[model samples]
Target: MIQKLRQSGTLLGFVLILLFFALKLPDTFLTARNLINISQQLSMLAVVAATMTIVMVMNDFDLSVGSMASLSGIVAAMIFTAGYPVWVGLSAGLLVGVLGGLFNGFLVSVVGILPFVATLGTLTVFSGMAFLLSDGKTIFGRDIPTSFSGFARSGIEIGDIKIPMLTITAGLVIFICWCILEHTNFGRRLYAIGGNKEASHLAGIKVVRLRLIAFSLTGLGAAGAGLMYAARVASANPTQGSGLMLDAIAAVFLGMTMSRRGEPKVIYTLVGVLILGVLDNGMTQLRVDSYVREILVGLIVLAAVSVSSLSKRRQS
Candidate 1:
């Protein structure tokens, strides 16, 4: 039993923390409204976290994701405000995101640049472009359609609980990602690359193509998140996605600690996002200062990563 518990410690720890928070703030946390709020608040992070996991699984990272998201949101808002259809605006945003991802892939694969360096350069470029497009202004107007807003605004009631559409969409995405990672050969190849890139390449796994696909998926995820956020707020600013990078990366790292396979998994990443969301909401409910909350989040992520790395080392 002790051995079994040690092997499954991360899942146990996640459960315990969730229960503790739910119990400690029962008056607020146990309510349906709060549950919905937590899900909605974490939706964007969850999307980015999933994408980041895929990138990490490919033994690469995309530092430009947050910037891409910001650019996508700004572009969507600008298009919408210019009398274009919402679908057209959404397509434009997604296209921009895909183009950014393709640029990163080109640098890393064709130019033989390191992933970190390539993405870092693109990050600054994309962010500057976003700022230039916005000209340091927030776009807001009442003409934004209800149909777009309804994508995030609607809710489903189960018993006394109302679950937001944003929450449902995030859940669906997580489920699909989980299936793809756990059941697909492509996912296995991604893990192979992460574990030993040279071996995977020698085995004819098409490392370049896999890495390109992974980066493209990251962009798609970020674009989806930006669209959702823009819809929720009914406005967009060039800086809207500035804070998402840290949160998404934190969730991805936290998730690495939870899976026994030593590979990033979608379900674990979603859980990690939920854990962070709950922490933030609970802290807010308890009136904790934002600075302290940020510090705690960072510490928690560091501790989890350290523990996970130690465990993997021991196992090896």
Candidate 2:
């Protein structure tokens, strides 16, 4: 049992957390409506978290994702309001993310800036751009077309089960990330770089390029998330994505002990986000204070990081 737990602790932890919430909030939490709500609410965050996970596993962090999402969503919505096609707006949003990632990568990989400082600086700048684009206002209504909102509003309805489009899109994003990380040489290089950059460099891997792609994907992920948010709310706001940074990062840390040990994976990251969603849902249903719930989340992040670090050391 101990050995098995060691092998798959993150999965076990997620299951236990889910069960705790279900038991505590029995009627309200375990119902289909609540479950659907949780999926819808977390779908955007999950997409952004997936992006952050790729950057993070490269032994780097991109603090700008939250702001990137804001900027991209605002840009896309602005384009839609201006009468451009939805695809055009969507493309513009994704472009913002890719470009943002490249800039971060350039700063860190080429300019030799530390990932922490570089992304932090960009985070501020990106956030400012978001505010500037929206002119510090929320966007909505007739200016925004129903077709654009349909992305968030549409869903597949089977006899008893309905899956929101946003949820399905998030699922597809997770699948793509898994394929990139697990099935490709690109993913292998990223894991290698994370494990040891110097060793990877000595082994002749293009560390810089891989890092660039990771950061780029992070931006793209953020942009994709932004689009999702816009569709859901039928509007965009500078403050729209402000609250996601911590939750997304915390989710990644909370899944650090996945089967890959020190390395995080898509499935593990999804579990991490789900745990957070479940926690927040159960607490809200139980009428837990917002401040208290946030504190609990912080504590969980700390605990997960500490345990993952200790496990890595023991394994080494």
Candidate 3:
């Protein structure tokens, strides 16, 4: 009964906060336009969070996600600027993302490097590559294809509410990720590894291989996000992916707290990302200073983590 109450309390608190912000900022936060804007703003973060959840569930981390995303975006832009077809550019971007992931996986699994160190090294290398490829300049030109632009611009309208295509894509990706994590043996192995790597290995799980796959998927997701970002902005810069690492990590941790699971869950991650978006939107509507918003977000995350830790202790 107490556990149920705790769970309910956590959910109820989140709901109340959301409602309060909606009511307080009805003209800005609760409007359809703002809701659509929030969706578009957080779509990339949502993608990155999905992959981060997978990696965390496998007891590993990928610090190179932001770098990989930047590199992918640069490559995509270079391809398009070089007159290649949009599909070709997208494929090249995704391929590069996969290669980056595989490289990180090889280092961690085959070379016996720690996941953190391996990804950190790759992160720096990939970021440098992005800058080198772009010649430290943002890629912007009229030659950018119309199809690509439409990919990001297109939306669905329901009454007065307009939803961006990328927003719908994000929802689909989250649902697919949730299905993978909750309904598959691979997912079970991932959670088992997170709970106890040694136990999972002793049970004949291919822990190393699974970890590699997780990292690869993380890279894939980040690259996909970069493509969407480029499509939305119609250009790519070397610094396009900067700061994404922090947002992605925060979303993952927030999701974990809400899920109260040993392993990360996609649905919870999406919810957490929405919570963050709402907070940011609400603060912006109130004309809150950017620094103050950051501080508030940091405090909220810290409090959530503390609560989650305390709950775990009680359960134990």
Q: What are the lDDT scores of the predictions, listed in order? A: 0.81, 0.86, 0.84
Q: Clashes in model 3: which pairs?
A: none
Report how far off residue 294 is in candidate 2 (Å): 1.1
lDDT of 2 by residue, 1-316 (tens): 4434554665666678778878887788888878988999999999999878898888789888889999998999889888998899999999999999999999989888999999999999998998898889888997678998987888899778788999899999999998999899999899999899999999999999888889999999999998899889999998788778888988887776665545777777898899898888888888899999999877876776666666666666
Best lDDT goes to which candidate?
2
Predicted candidate 1 versus true structure: per-residue lDDT over 1-316, tens digit per residue: 3333433555666677678777888788878778788889998888888877888887688888888888898898788878899899999999988888878888887787999999999889988988899887877776566777777888788897778888888888777777777789988888898999899999999988888877888887887788888888887778788777778877877777776665777877887798788889888887889999989877877877777776677666
Candidate 3 off by > 4 Å: 5-10
Question: Residues 1-316, candidate 3, lDDT per residue (tens digit)?
Answer: 5455444444565687779887887667777788889899999889989888888887688888898888899999899989999999999999998888988988987798998999999999999999999999888767567788688999898887778999998888787777778899998888998999889999999988988887888898889888888888888888788677888888887777766463578877787788788888888888889999999899887887777778777887
Instruction: lDDT for model 2, please.
Output: 0.86
For each candidate in turn, the TM-score is 0.93, 0.94, 0.95
Q: Which window of 10 residues has the lowest lDDT sum in candidate 1?
A: 1-10
Please tell me which model should have the higher lDDT, number 2 or number 3: 2
Weakest lDDT window of 10 consecutive positions for candidate 3 = 1-10
